[model samples]
Target: MLQKFQVNLMASKLLWTIFMGLLIPTSYSVFFNTTTLLEWSLFSISSTPIMLTLILDPLGLMFSCSVLMISANVLKFSTIYMKEDKFINRFTVLVLMFVLSMNMLIFLPHLMMLLLGWDGLGIVSFILVIYYQNPKSLAAGMITALTNRIGDVMLLLAIAWTLNQGHWNILHMWMLDENMYQVLTITLAAMTKSAQMPFSSWLPAAMAAPTPVSALVHSSTLVTAGVFLLIRFYPFMSSAWWFTPLLLLTAVSTTLMAGLSATTECDMKKIIALSTLSQLGMMMAAMGMGMVHLAYFHMITHALFKALLFVCAGSFIHSHMHSQDLRWMGNLANQMPATSSCLVMANLALCGFPFMSGFYSKDMIVEASMFYQHNLLMVTLMLVAMGLTSFYSTRFSLCVVWGTNNCNPYIYLEESNPLTSPMLTLASMSVISGAIIMWVAPLKQEMMLIPMYQKLMPLILVLLGASLAWLISATKQKNESMLMQTQINHYASCMMWFLIPLSSQFPMKLPMYLSHNYLKLMDQSWLEALSGQGINSLSVKSSNILMSASKPMPVNYLMMSSMLGLMIMMVMF
Candidate 1:
């Protein structure tokens, strides 16, 4: 139908219209400090009420608006990006469902109702990740699905645990007592969803998906669901003494891992995916420092710029005939000016440059780190991770966008308005959204006291990271001299400290090995001896013995003599 009518682009227009329709009210909700609580009992089960509860608040509405805006642009972008795919309709529907699931997670206050979105993300993400229908996509999809399944189970456990409270609304769970297990599960669920530490492998592997799915999943929908869940549950989960410390460790480790991984990665989409992971760590770090609002603010800002970054990256891939390796992407600046320009701004925003979208929230979090009392080691790691963020972003931009021509000099690179317009829209947001949100959003005013040096720490880290990147880029001679060392470090970094294998193959290998051994022990050994083979052997031996009796008449005679003897004994009695 889309092929016949060419309204392949109309869905995005409709979505954009809805976005414009809701933007005013959502902004009003933010400015006027308005929130609405809506509750309706859907049904009763065994004296328990199943309710559909929605929170029409600044945060929910604002986030919903962001999701719609990004989705609309992504859909428009996909019309051109996926123009040649045979199953474009299927892809469009899947993307719509993905957006719907995220919106559900954003608004629903009820835990049970929230699961509809939470699990929907997991299921739909797996499908999108493997949409290419290849072994690599399948493997990546498996890692993504299994890792998220951990969070899904944790969420379900939280819902079951809270069922005893007679209400499933998470809004009121803050006052309830003895929520230790509940908070722990909620934290675990959030960590896995956001791809922190042990669950970090899937985020990068999910780059096997199409660039559009990566734009959505890495930006706001799938990966952000965890942080969003944590934000919602923060009121109750923060009561635990260990909450901050746990998240602190998770954030630092994940940031370090992703930053290092991005520096060495050659795949364009994976590089951006790793950046998303690093930003998520920053968000988690903010929450860990007891700055929940800062974390949420960072999440929102990150979503905008990250989505923009992915769209720009997607355009690069499309121009190069779907080549995503950074090594093959240089000299694109002159060939594709619009994409190159948007890519530069996206990277700038990602680095949290002054006045960019990321600066408002990210800089606050950086300062708050100094104000908070997380141990010396945690603070150092956090600062180092921030520096690494800038380093990788700079390194990536230097390698892919501004480097010398690495591909065919005469290759055609198309930059249509339909393609460039989405990046332009998101790029504008990436620039101005931070300042607008800072002025409009009514965040709690925290009185922060820090020395001038401490206040400059984040900027200093950014400068330092960029310097290191430039230094390395200029020092290629020394790097080439230590080729073996360079190769070793690159391999390790590309493997993400061996996390990719551990998460993807280790889980599969161990289970398969164990099942193989179990088969050898049970089916091949004991079961053969005690059940089928053993029974067969016994019956065979007995049959042979009967056949060895020489004749059927001899066996019949023996049976008759035994029966006659028993009859004589009965008569004597």
Candidate 2:
């Protein structure tokens, strides 16, 4: 126990120190409106400097600071959360590696070196996801790893395609002869990593991991890696005429899908996971609209709140005997006051409550996006997604309040320092980080000149969504009603419009089915009989005949053999 405390204490201090160090310089960079790109010339190839570049710009440093702060708190939180587990040290090491991978991604801008972080995120995430080592965890890990491999392959192709350019740095890409292929591949890679449409099945399934892992991976490490990648490439990728439309479709589809799914989700972790998907789409949509800074700004703000939400969720889950279903949770607000308050703050931030951290970024992104887009259908859908975000948050709160079907009346909440400390730390940031970030980040203020009614749309959407959720909760205590009441409707929305099966399972079904049949029809049938049983039986029979002939060969068998040979020879003559 003492050892755990000491290790976490030292680690947290180290991370916090590093975070502060980065934060100071990043603040100075933003304040002075300066950008620094330091390159070390490793060697020269064809007179082209094969240099290694480090990006110390406001974006990367600020993100790195956010990641480090969150990591420090999460490590502190995990010390208590996994207290009963025997292998807590292993967990600590894995979390550290996860943070290391993310930092690698943040500082390194060279495409070749970027894979050190990109693939590291995938590998470490898979290991962390399957840390529990059960069948379900293994399945989730496979889905996560396999789905991400698509992006990795596309990234490799992008790298190879740019190999002729003599350098793989982001700044050097503008000089390429043809960049569309690289853009397409890189976009595809980002979509998979960010869990965009058709590649989003693994995001919710990733809840198989521990809550701390979920907080880190879902918030700012694994899933956000894609958004960061696109941000690094946006100046170039968006120049392609088709990039915006493609990204828009991917982003909006993911947003709508995740929004719909979250409203119907029963699992608390899965609900938050879906919300992460929703926010990732928001970032992607902001990127799609050519608002790179806005997307990044939202990423930072979302990371703060989402990490808090997961910590709070972890506390509730720990209090509830590890049951994750909303129907099984109740009275947490009364029992775990601090954690529950933090939970409320996180959800309110998610709904873009007035002047909160999320409001600064999410509202601005949506408003600026709506202002830029002329399409009425897309605008309505975006509003629907915004509305659904509130609806699900309200539904979640309602269920948490009323749920008692699976709760133990005698259970006590453990609101220890390890639990409440991280929650409060993140909660404070989630509330005010937006304003702080706005002041410190490069874009001090963004002026969007949208009309008043459209600008008021977000408030209207929130009120209507919350009202709808209250109505549903009041009317459907025993029998639930949803946006769609039919069996098919419920299934469609809950399954993310059948994306789970299509993206994760459908691709492997044919190959697995063929292998199953081959085992049954070939390996177990004639092949098994002939190569296994038949050969064994034939060897047995031949051994018996040899045994019988061996004894007779000493006496009468020799005379018989000689007579037989002589008779055969005379007959042939």
Candidate 3:
């Protein structure tokens, strides 16, 4: 019976994946009210859809579709990816938990319930990331875990602040009042979760996990949690006057920085992971600038192509005996034709080539960014970011598909179905998804594409970037930078000096730095530090003193003599 129970876990996990994938479209089909010919009078028709009403907006539907599609592919891929692993049972359970949690997160009506689902998803990702139990992988898992917690803290603070202002119901919350604080808190939280700018390094380190984990968590669902939060709370976000401008600034900077890193990165997974961060930053910028449609479009397109790239990379690794570094790979297009073709198509979508899904939404985001405030520097930064995105994206393609091969003898290519089928499915989606989305939702009427000259800029940047990256690769100029070397050395030193020690010294330095300035900023603006700390300490100390005094006292000879003397005096009286 125990063996049978263990045997059934995998099937149960897979079943849940299928169920989650179908739940959204099924719900939408059943609940979409079409009475009175789609648009009635000022007061539209009434509909009471079960749970679907929680997050039934167009943006919500887009994320629902993304979560479903990615969860399905990850589950199928895991079946083959975890076949030989010892912790398959645990891995399968966490995968199912992650899927169910994310599905619940988008539909949660109450803020607390939404947070519950959000934190659950993060926890499951952390567990899955460390499934290999290697030293470096464990460290990577720790980094992701801590960063996620920091993001959660900001969200919790925002929720508490909202509740303090007597706004427990999000629908009734007003953004025009003193809601700027809440907006800032939520924005900070979202940026951290999405791996924007200074908080971006964690995603690349997360590549230490197995390919399936990276494909599902980093590329598909987990990193997008912040964007989902922003989209879900768009009404409140739109209320903040400064929020859009700030988001635009951060997005442009994050995209450019991540793009630069991606150009020099050699790790196959790391390059895609960084690019995902950059792309997500652009999505946030779009949403912040009131381009929700463009944001949703880009999110859908990014999910398809990023997942395809990760899955195809997995296939390449499985075929080439676990080699993930792009520098040592060359001419794999001829060797793994199916995998190569999928990779090329996926990369094309990422590059925003003509007629691809990425070209539609990505161009929309850049255009929207340009229209908001129209700062020349921000526009230039965004353009440079586009070029960087193209440069690194092309670098990834060149190394994996067209580079020289140093044949490793121990590598054993997996059987075709194990490596090719799932990848082909993802790759096909990468190609077809853009067309389907374009047909389903035309952005021309919604976003108003940028002028012809403006559109030409990104294309020209793309061509220039691809050419520059190819030259860099050909010239053998790729080397680790001083900053990167310092980071690697610092992390190495920590593991060697502190992690090896017997004491419980935590890896809290990074967390401290991120939380410090923000906490200080909050304290200065809202609460006083001395009073809060003093009151808390005083309450604790007084409670301890009262507790000590409440202990029972012993009665001995001294008490008895006093009682006897008192009794004699009373008798005399």
Best by TM-score: 2
Q: Give the clash count for model 3.
A: 1
Candidate 1 lDDT over 227-270, as tens digits, reads 99889888888888888889988898899888877877778888
Clashing pairs in 2: none
Candidate 1 wrongly placed segments (more than 4 Å): 1-7, 175-177, 447-449, 477-488, 524-573
Clashing pairs in 1: none
Q: What is the C-alpha lDDT of each candidate?
A: 0.86, 0.85, 0.70
lDDT, candidate 2, 478-556, per-residue tens? 3254645788988998889999888777888999999999999998887977785976776568556766777655665
Model 3, stretches more than 4 Å misplaced? 1-53, 164-167, 371-373, 442-450, 475-573
Pairs that collide in candidate 3 are: 330-403
When sorted by TM-score, best at the front, the candidate numbers are 2, 1, 3
TM-score of each predicted structure versus truth: 0.90, 0.91, 0.77
Task: Please write out the lDDT profile of model 3 over residues 375-399, one tens digit for every residue.
Answer: 7887788788888788777778887
lDDT agreement of model 1 with the native? 0.86
Candidate 2 root-mean-square deviation in Å: 4.6
C-alpha RMSD for every candidate = 4.8, 4.6, 10.3
For each of the candidates, give the backbone clash count.
0, 0, 1
Which 10-residue window of candidate 2 scores lowest in summed lDDT?
A: 1-10
